[model samples]
Target: MPGCCLWGSAPPAPSGERKGAGWLELLLLLLLILSGWVLTQQPVGCPRVCECFVEEKTVKCANQNLTEVPPDLPRDVQNLFLTGNRLRDLSSGAFPSEPLLELRNLSLRGNQLEQVGAEAFARLPNLKQLDLSQSALLWVSPMAFGNASSPLEELRLSNSLYNYSVVAAIAELLQRGIFQNLKHLDLSSNGLVSLPPGIFSRLPSLQHLDLHNNSLVSLRDVSFGALHQLQRFDLGDNALKRLRNDTLAQLRGLPWLTRLDLGRNAWVCDCGIEDLARWLKESDQVEAKEALKCSEPEEKQNSSLVSLPISGLECLEPDDDQTQLQTSYVFLGIVLALIGAIFLLVLYLNRKGIKKWMYNIRDACRDHMEGYHYRYEINADPRLTHLSSNSDV
Candidate 1:
């Protein structure tokens, strides 16, 4: 009976055991409180000027008037925005003192960056996207990035690269096989007059190229020859008067091309632009098809390029120089024909004399051969020589 407990009836425990149980429960509660506090606290290592989101792993220092990159930043940040700053130069080790191994995207747009030093982004090994648009970037070292086989896929240099020299430098860098994994590139509003040949040859994976709002008068066929994966190309708002058939053929050769922008250009509706106008009519890839209008030749100033028929785009009457050249060619050809006819007529009129002269030459050759033959026989035999001499006497 003493060892057995009845229903809803139990024996009391010792005070020491009770106290031990209470202490254990208190310890568990304290531990939970501490863990909750740790979870709620803000992440450390955030720079004073930056707003860092711990959960998203993003750091935004945009429009902060920062002269340099913040020295203290979370080591695991993936996206960093440093736009609208006064960062004039980006030297090597441009990031924080310690490398951000997890960084994937970096933006330096709207900065006053004049130069980018060698291996400036060497620390960010996993970087995939970079934005340097709206900056005054005058120079970028060929080795600004450490790896030629970098994983960077998107690069924006719009509104930068003011002169041909800067563009040439960038072209040289691309030709060196840097950023081989690049996909999207923005070079719009760069005041480019012409792109260097084979400029995009090394970028085999490029899918989107934006070159709108430039001063490009013409494009070489080889400029986009290697962009087999290109899907979108923007050549709008340029100073182009006409596109050559070879250039249009090159555009058509892009297997993946889906969107093309050629509007807002100074198109001239003439024989020189027949190829482009015909291409516009036949192809549906051109964006803003209705806005492409002719700007020259008072009669076609406001005409749409897409609506103009190939027959309507006629060559103007031959200029004086062209007429003169054509006349000279015709005269030369006639003179040659007349000379040939005269020569034939002269040969016919002198046929008899020519035949007699030919017979005289043949007889002289025959007699001379016979004399040589007789001399050889006389030399070979002494009897023959004496006999011939006696006969002669």
Candidate 2:
């Protein structure tokens, strides 16, 4: 009787309430299981060898000893770094069949890539920057970027082209107008002796050009004529002897140029180098002006180009004149020799005619001599003349 009053006791929970609580508990357990599974699993669509940052949309497969590109790259990965791998060649099918529509940066540095196929990067439509540094790139197809207009802006090929042929290949590739929008080009440490004329003519938008640590001996005035928008240029650590006045003038005319590097070169401080020395002393654009010392002429050796007086950078005018005169004499001698050779060749070609002419002259001379002898005899001996007249009668 003491516990019999159901109204006094708390009312029992409704079946609907119990059912709802059970359902909530079940949902929470399912959520917990899913979260655990997700925590244990790799990122969705990420390759096993690569680390993918989903939030940033970057995938790093560097130093993985990958023989080929990871096939399972995230569809939305914007920056893909495949550096320090063993990828020897980038064939047409190196990337996945599905194009990475958002990929912006690609790095293949430190690979053993010897060749780049024509369609190697055809799928990366929106790619902006490419770094192929430290690769043993021996050959690159002229159409390596495919037929579509490239949106590439920065191209880093430093220390990649091992030989002149490879450099020439890249030069040919550049002449094809594939990377017209390129803004920054790094060709440093490539041992380039000389660049093909008009190689950078198509890259009108080029701003930064790095040609340091090369074997370039000279540069043409048109070497950078197309780089009107160029801001920074590096020509350090080369075998350059002098920059002519016209070349210096062209460099001075760059409207946007802010930095110029001519240090560590084999600068010959002669009258020929006076223009460069004067420019270095006057302009604030040259970097490491102190390091641009005269590497030739024992007296001027190690002298800083900027500090050297323009008068000090002089050549013996008399000696130059004598040298020019000697050179002119040698040139004249060569021309005379060539003319003599040509005349001899012509005579040899008409030898038969010449011989006939000589024979005809000898015959005419002999005939004239005989007639003269006969006339003299007739004039000297009247008896001989009378005998000749009797024979005619």
Candidate 3:
């Protein structure tokens, strides 16, 4: 009878029924299917246009005609090669800054970049090397790279279309020590006429400096005061006439300096150049000593600066004794000329009196001659006087 009652109870509903479990399973199955579909729709890492080496963490996007940074770059990219791109300007957030935190090397060379925003590289904390060369850059904001979290080691802004305005802003940045950790800096081929005083004072760690192919007129003694660790200095192909002895002294302050390129410049080879010549000969710092030439003093023209003796290079001082003597002679001659002119003027003004005095002298001389003649005639009349005495007797 008990078995009969259990059968009527529908076998206890087969014992394992949980009412909500089917719906829960169905929901989980739908969620998993949805996740799989999403995963399949997403492409693999790296943008379609870029070739990324995930293992090496390097991205080669060079010459990609990329107008803007791709949005789908891997987050682990360290070296980014965006050279020869059509990137006009580096505005803030142009590239996803968060994804580029690990980026170390950035190459923007050959790009048509004219301006760079201040917050352009603010998000790249580990960035060390940057190449903005050949960018046709006309202006750079003074606040560019301001408060940068990166320790930029190498910077190349050379061959950019930097006029005085851009160069001045750059000088201001250098003077303020914006890139203090920079070791190698290339500012060559910039149309720089002159550098601001104490421009390199803040770059204490700078080891190599390139100022070649510029229109630099001079370098001051205090210009490299803070570059105590400088090893190489390139002033070749510049418009430099001469370097001051004091400036040479400042260059000497760098004990580690090994290579100096002073060739292809307009060297005067005068007294002011003696110190540099001596340095070129004696010091082992000059790298291209043989290539150095003098452009001035027709005699020293094209002569090798290194071989020229220091004694041969003598500058004529503007205030030297010889100059002073010449000046004094000129002054004396002028004074004599003035005196002679005054005398002539006086003679001309008193022409009538002078003429009357000359006439009076002529008359007096004539009267004296006539008197002499009359005396001679009287002496000759002595015989007549004797005849007259006889008649009186």
Top-lDDT structure, candidate number: 2
Model 2 lDDT per residue over 48-75, tens place: 9888887888899999999999998888
lDDT of 2 at 274: 75
Better of 1 and 3 by lDDT: 1
Give the candidates in order of lDDT, highest first: 2, 1, 3
TM-score order of candidates, top first:
2, 1, 3
Provide the overall lDDT of each model, using Cα atoms, as 2-decimal numbers.
0.85, 0.86, 0.79
Query: In candidate 3, what residue range of length 10 has the lowest lDDT sum?
Result: 384-393
| TM-score result, candidate 1 | 0.69
Candidate 1 off by > 4 Å? 1-41, 316-393
Candidate 3 has an lDDT of 0.79
Of 1 and 2, the candidate ahead on lDDT is 2
- Scored by TM-score, the top model is 2
Lowest lDDT sum, 10 consecutive residues, model 2, at 316-325
C-alpha TM-score for every candidate: 0.69, 0.70, 0.67
lDDT of 1 at 303: 92
